[model samples]
Target chain A: MSIKLTIMDEMARVAREHGKILAPLDDDLALLDCGLDSLGIAVLVARLEDKLGLDPFTTAEEVQFPVTVGDFVKAYEHGAH
Target chain B: MSTALTDAQPLRARLTGATADAVFFDRAARVRVADLVCRTSLCGGRADLGGRAVLLVTASQLTAALALIELDGMVRRLLILPPDVDPDHLGALIAGAEIDAVVTDGTLPPQLAGLPVRVVCTPGIVPLAEPPRACERTEWVLLTSGTTGVPKMVAHSVAGLTAALAPSASAEPVVWGTFYDIRRYGGLQIFLRAVLGGASLVLSSAGEPVAEHLARLARHGVTHLSGTPSHWRRALMSPEIGRIAPRYVRLSGEIADQAILDALRAAFPRADIGHAYASTEAGVVFAVDDGRAGFPARFLNGARNGVEIKIVDGCLRIRSPGAALRYVGGAKTAALHDGDGFVDSGDMVERQGDRYVFVGRQGGIINVGGLKVHPEEVEAVINRHPRVRMSLVRAKRSPFTGALVVADIVLTAPAAAAGNEAELRDDILKLCRGALPRHKVPAAISFVPALAVAATGKLARRGV
Candidate 1:
């Protein structure tokens, strides 16, 4: 699967298991405005790190946290490249 | 004047006529009573805060802070504010307490600059004025380690606080050290004990690495050292633990689990390693010196010195002449005490064979090391996220800190579908980091379908 697809799938799984998402997934959505919280986000990151074998937040020398869904995906994409 | 008024000696009477040299030693300098007296007189005169509410921001300079405390005791109602407190929160505290002056070491936060309180920055002597007469009833207002909301101000009289302290055992003045800062209750107890006993104190600097702190204690030949279990754990982890050979080692602030007690015994076989049960409200309750985790069960309803202890419905209750008079600006004295005057300690104890062990807090407060963290406070912050339906904060056992904070969160459906949980978590953490102190930050975050609620319509905290 593509990195974007994998990240999305993990996010959906975490959300479905913990809380319900009333709207459609999109890049423009502010992550904080979404239903997920810090713990849910942490689970998603751990899943992504497991599959991709890279955690951008932990491995990066200086990590600027991504505020939006698009920026988050971009962070993973940059790390992958 | 009443007999009590005439009988009450000035608070400075504790420090009067001590041997003129090496009274307080830190990494940088040695302070004498004469030096302290002169400085105190100069500060008292310069600040001229006569019987006003004075907020003391120690900023972890133990020597200067102690001197300021001595001065405040003489002429002002001292409010000891922790050095690590958030500046904005501190401003609220200062305003709430109606502080008239501030004595600090040149590091006052910008938020407090505009306050009407007189600011006396330390290490410089101002021109001296005639010293004012000390009050017969000097109040020392301390802030409770608020885990849920704003910290409460607890008022204690100087005489009542020092009433229970035992005189120094040895004729030769001993050297004392503690892991707590002078602003904190536990550290203040040690400071008062050292002063009342006529011993010199080695004050630990805040934010100094544990290895360096331990090295300093060793270099200064600290004979009696006291710390929380967490502090000891950090000290044990340090490579320089072998440097200090104290004659007495004490543990307080957190539950003294068997593992920590055994570790201390192994580390300091010759030292009298003991753990004490004490609180800001209850003063020093009891000390267990048997290298055990819990006190004997028989201590219930037992009187030690002047303090009495008993367990009420699994909660430890204490009645002492030295107990804090009342929580200032908050709860009344009646609300905290029983009909007979025993203060509800808010700590839950469990019966373990012949001993009673402290399990945790009954009031849903999480103790991370010796510091208190309220779950409601963290939950309130997490619930602010637009997508979050609710959040539950709890403590998980940790080796580094005694307990690590973890948050379980429930999200809104649309946000869940967005599949951006990682980013959401980071954002939430950032929000908490910006708002809460470092120790109050949640170490781990996890997603939950729902938070359990009790049958009585309250959030269920059992088995967390």
Candidate 2:
């Protein structure tokens, strides 16, 4: 499965658990500006790392933190590769 | 009798004659009290800082700072400056306090060089002069952690400060260990208690790695260990944690969460794990020994263990002899205290069944890994950016650091028109990096539509 799809699935799972309804994933949408709070972001990251086996957010030294869904997906893709 | 005459006894008088050989071991060297006293006296006399403020720059050498503190009445005041203090901040502190001399183990930093003050090195022997008159007015000025902007200077009389401490329960001498800088309040309390109890302290160097420091504590057979919960958390992560077996373990400087407390108890089954509620303003408050997270709620409105704990409007208020007399440099203590003289501890608490647990700061201060960071202070800096309209700073839960700093910003109309959030975030981060300390800088920045203000007409602080 692609990193983008995996991240969307994790976000969906987190939103479901938190009872938060997430809008459909879009590249330009800011992740934080969405329904996901910091806790939700953390949970999504953890779950994605479990399924996809890489977390660029934690591993990269001088990471420019992802602001949008596209950047978030790209970070995981870069780490996995 | 006059207060000065009654309280002006030499600090050395507290030490027993038989314990003259008790050692203070640091990473560099070990020195006995007998030798340290003689050397400090010599250095004190030659420096000739007769009744003037002297800045004692300490660099992980607890004994050296202790020796200078032992010269209680010889100097007017001793401002204990930590090694990692920002040079600009140090200069401001010195100038604000009107420091006349500096006594340090090593060379003075370049920021302090141009100041018109006498510089003297410690642990050096010089020709001794007649001992200076014992002035009881000698005060020890400690700098606050300065999580806000500039560190506040807190002045405490030696007599009053020592009077506030609880007497050591142990009759036999025990080896002590602490993860606090000797200059700060938590570390200073342990340092003073260990010395007065005639115990040997294995001083941990701030510059050393956690593993090496824990190894030294194990080698010294440290029986009593005190540190912040963050410190304990880091120590527990180190493999060397198993090497040291402390009989008494204390957690202070941060809220002692249950997980950390439980982990500590499991790690050292034989140790008495307890957490004490203390602040730089209000000295040592009550300590909870149930190996739990918070103190019993009954402690409120009741005097237990000779200390009074009261809850006034959901804020923890304490009245202790160890509480600081007043804030120096015209900072008002009126707002910090009530009409009845109880200090507002700035900590908000909630009753969890029979026990009271710390929720967060009522003052909107973000406690990032035991260091207090005022959100307003960070927000003020972020808002100063030309492109920024306003900012909301908050604490984010971090596994490594107890809490990490994060900021959400609202950009100005002109800047928002640029449509480059990434570049704007980087610019704000760079601006903060230059103005604030590394820890105070926001770990992550997010752009938001608007910051919410509560009905009380203040920025709503979201509790972690």
Candidate 3:
């Protein structure tokens, strides 16, 4: 099943906060790279942790993913269970 | 930062008093609090508890309380664990060790649903409890392997530890920064030195952001920074290194070379970049800083008798005041021991005139077939280049060669400058071939923007 739109919105909010423009979720998520640096990704993960109340990404490799907003939402949704 | 007067009078006086209330743990205000803890523990009835009565809380407030316990003579044992440790493991360890009373934030270990030890959850309440006396020497125990493998308890004495701290040179007030776990010995030294000197301790919010850490140094006006060679290299590569500066930079827990020293000097022109040599078992050995990259002649030409260092069988042997009593259960015995007292660290060394330089750990020297290849030796060659910021050389399994040297590099310049992966590969290979020995040269190179540095700013060599 696909992720909820609310997750996409929150992901977008995080991307925007990190000074990245998020493409629409309808597009291929992998195509839209937000170019989030380490600190930016850290902020995104922290926000997601607070929002989801779960530590989704612990390792550096996991955090390096979600190059784009759509990719982030998808990853979060996939791991939501 | 500021050595402002505490709300109370001088700490020595309160420590001497029958009843004294003071802040026990503070990352920022360590020296004052440590001094207070040391004084009170020594004078008060609790002096005997040494490591046992002391309930070491991971939180700054709890650490403060533990410091007070250390002073009050109430602490009979010390349970050293990081704030982030698994509560289940902590409780199990505490229970297995039979900790008398726990001084924690009432955060019960998941495994410790119900324990017999009295729990002191609040700092406000710790002071109110009847003054617990000091614990016995046999009670001083530290977690065996840390987060790795199974955890065991290693016992130490207060006099042994106090003796450990006393032999080292007195620390001057400086900002103490590190990337190692606070629970680990490496991290504890930084904490100990800061508490001893009362310096501001700047912890990394973002793990080892060398640039960000340097900025924090500027923000907090931190004077002293400590870490492994890898950490120092990160700080050197940090764009902020050229921008902000620290007063003193110390490299420890690993071998440091000229390349790292040169890079740090380039980054912090005004700072005193040096080496602080020590081990987990050996508390604080002699530190070598020649105001340049290589080792110095015992700081002042073997002037201090507290630490005596020599090279035997091409290995570094040292006897110092801060050396540990003995390893509890480790296979390795007193390294390079003379009949009388001195201990060898099982590390090879090269003598360049008076100063002795560390070559590599005896255990780590990789045997590629028969030729011995030290990882640091290969790393130093690669790191000498201006574009290469950091390099980790490790032996990789190879079907043809048995084991070939592999280097993972982080560049100071953009990766695209080499045009593409193939070209970058060729260029680096050519550079290594021309500069290094056949066996010493890396067979494979992976250009990464940054290498994975552990929290204590040391290179993570295991997974790589």
Question: What RMSD does each model have against the real structure?
Answer: 13.2, 13.0, 15.2
The model with the greatest TM-score is: 2
TM-score of chain B of 2: 0.75
B106-143: candidate 2 lDDT, tens digit per residue: 67778778655654555444333443456546778877
lDDT per residue (tens digit) for residues B157-274 in model 1: 7777776777766765578898876577777888887766767888766556778889998888888999876567557767899999998999987666665676678788899988
Candidate 1 ranges beyond 4 A from true positions: A1-81, B1-4, B20-22, B38-47, B117-132, B330-334, B364-464
lDDT of 1 at B321: 76
Give the Å error, residue B407, model 3. 0.6
- Across residues A3-79, which tens digit of lDDT does each residue of candidate 2 receive? 67778887886676555889877899998876876656764664565578776776666556788989988988878
True-vs-predicted CA distance for residue A53, candidate 2, Å: 15
True-vs-predicted CA distance for residue B103, candidate 3, Å: 3.5
Strongest candidate by lDDT: 2
Candidate 1 overall lDDT versus native: 0.69
DockQ of every predicted complex: 0.04, 0.04, 0.01
Ranking by lDDT: 2, 1, 3
List candidate 2 segments past 4 Å from native. A1-12, A20-81, B1-3, B17-20, B37-47, B114-116, B124-133, B330-336, B363-464
